[model samples]
Target: MTLAWLCLMWVFLSATVATLPLRIQFIPGAILLVAGPVLIIVIGLQVGFVFSVIALAAYVSMFRNPLLFLLARLRGRKIEVPR
Candidate 1:
């Protein structure tokens, strides 16, 4: 129950941060990016794997571009971000 509320709040907060300018979003965006996996794992342990999988899908959907960029970087592809 508490985890569900936290997940909802996280989504809303992420959406709010997303509306900020790129420069302004950097810090908060990074924070949310980092917090995501930890939250997912904690919730999964508390709840169940199915819910965590759903949450992971939502998280990936929301952070698609960034995650792709990260993957590309790991694969040694040169990528650029707009200012």
Candidate 2:
């Protein structure tokens, strides 16, 4: 029950972030990016690795752009923000 609620909340928050303008989405998006892995860990412990992996896939798909940007920054590549 709790895991289901958390998943739903994650989906809702992700959807809300998607609706906002890119600049405005940054803070909440970053919060979700940080929280996502912790939730995946808890989900794995509560349920199983398979379910956790599925959740992680969903998370990665939803945040692909931000994740890619972070990766680029980590690699010392320049990221250009479109106007």
Candidate 3:
């Protein structure tokens, strides 16, 4: 679980940084390039499916796309009730 969380954090941070100005983004990417392998080797880090779910939530919140959010909510509701 810890490994998965770390991987998710790294990926989320990397993507967030990439969307920033090049000057700010490059440093993190370089750091990740250098440290990523170490993280995998030392911790067996990997992102989990939960990160994607959270990311989608964030995207919906930021974009306020009612259609997508409604669909997602419906899907989630179906899963929970299964009716």
Predicted candidate 1 versus true structure: per-residue lDDT over 32-55, tens digit per residue? 999999899988999999988998
What shift in Å separates residue 28 of candidate 3 from its native position after superposition? 1.7
Q: Candidate 3: worst 10 consecutive residues by lDDT? A: 59-68
By TM-score rank, best first, the candidates go: 2, 1, 3
Against the true structure, what is each candidate's TM-score?
A: 0.89, 0.93, 0.45
Worst lDDT window (10 residues) for model 2? 2-11
Q: Write the per-residue lDDT of candidate 3 for residues 20-79, one digit (tens) a residue.
A: 876565467567655555554544224545655664555445334334445789777532
| Cα RMSD for candidates in order | 1.3, 1.0, 13.4
lDDT of 3 at 23: 57
Residue 27 lDDT, candidate 2, scale 0-100 = 90
Poorly placed runs, candidate 2 (over 4 Å)? none
Model 2: how far residue 41 lies from native, Å: 0.7
Give stretches of model 3 more than 4 Å off. 43-83
Model 2 C-alpha lDDT per residue in residues 1-83, reported as the tens digit of each score: 98889878988998999899988988998999999999999999999999999989988998899899999999999999764
83 Cα displacement, candidate 2 (Å): 4.0
